[model samples]
Target: MAIVNATDQTFVTETSTGVTLVDFWAPWCGPCRMIAPVLEEVDQEMGDKVKIVKVNVDENQETASKYGVMSIPTLLVFKDGNVVDKTVGFQPKEALVQLLQQHV
Candidate 1:
């Protein structure tokens, strides 16, 4: 599935269902930019098995703060609305795939 761009208002609903990877990022963050393409590939390869959502820290501060995302590129894996796993910084495609696979 395509990566969904979520906002503070929609963050809960967007991640309320099955396995989801919530990428807390910002446009100005280099690590976030580096992970963008990797996330896209994860979406393409994982397809219906996982849902990828991105929340821009610059615009969605509430969501980021709620999750205690102290830095850019904080990736949280949620299952049925609860976080099951997490990672930070720019992760390679393989690492991301492995992270999702655990929850999938």
Candidate 2:
């Protein structure tokens, strides 16, 4: 599954109905680069069980600011449109999967 691009316009609705994992990242963020593959792996492994979305902080500053994303590679897990879990920096694929599983 391809990672969905979540912007300020789509976030509320997209995340509201399902288990959505939103990655708040910037183009220049090294940690975000490191987690890119992990997210892709999760997308494939979890398939439709979860929705993975990427938000480019550079292009979508309003959404990023709304979420109070203070650092790069911030992972926010939303269930039923409400944020339930949050992690900052790079995380291993297993750790991320576990995090997602908790909400799933």
Candidate 3:
């Protein structure tokens, strides 16, 4: 499945079911840019096992703050609406796949 763009208004419902990876990032963040392609590959390869969602920190501050996302490119893995794992900064594709593998 394609990655879904989420906002503060819809973040909860978007991540309420199944395994989800929520990327909290901003356009100005270089690390966030670096991780974009990795996320895309993950979505392509493991779309059936997990759902990916992105929230722009610039436009969705409430959701970011609610999750205590202190930095850009903060990746949170949610299972059935609760956060299960989290990582910060740019992560290699291998690492990303491994991260999602745990929850799937």
Candidate 4:
């Protein structure tokens, strides 16, 4: 599936199943900007194997706070409504795929 822009209201429902990578970021964060394209490549390569979503920390603080996302470009991997793993900062596509491979 395509990358989804998840809101606080939709986060729970959207990331409730399978392997999901929720990127907690803001538009002005440099690292977040740097990681956006990498996530795109990962989304395309992984396809239905994973669900990729973006949660703008500036816009969705509740969700970000709930996840304890103190930094931008924080990536949370969720399975069945629980966070299985999390990574922070910018990472290359290969590294992201490897991260997903651990949970998927």
Q: Give the TM-score of candidate 3.
A: 0.98
lDDT per residue (tens digit) for residues 12-96 in model 1: 9999999999999988899999999999899999978999999999899999999999988999999999999999999999999
Candidate 3 C-alpha lDDT tens digits along 1-104? 99999999999999999999999999999999989999999999999989999999999989999999998899999999999999999999899899989888
TM-scores for all candidates?
0.98, 0.96, 0.98, 0.98
How would you order the candidates by lDDT, starting with the best? 3, 1, 4, 2
Model 2 scores worst on lDDT over the 10 consecutive residues at: 9-18
Q: Model 2, residue 71: what's the lDDT?
A: 91
Model 4, span 1-102: residue lDDT tens: 799999999999999989999999999999999999999999989967999999999999999999899988899999988999999999999989999999
Off by over 4 Å in 4: none
RMSD (CA, angstroms), candidate 3: 0.6
Candidate 2 lDDT over residue span 23-101, tens digit each: 9998899989999999999999996899998999998999899889999899999999899999999999999999999
Residue 93 miss distance in model 3 (angstroms): 0.8
User: What TM-score, to 2 decimals, does candidate 1 have?
Assistant: 0.98
Which predicted model would earn the best lDDT? 3
RMSD (Å) of each candidate, 1 decimal: 0.6, 0.8, 0.6, 0.6
lDDT of all predictions:
0.94, 0.92, 0.94, 0.93
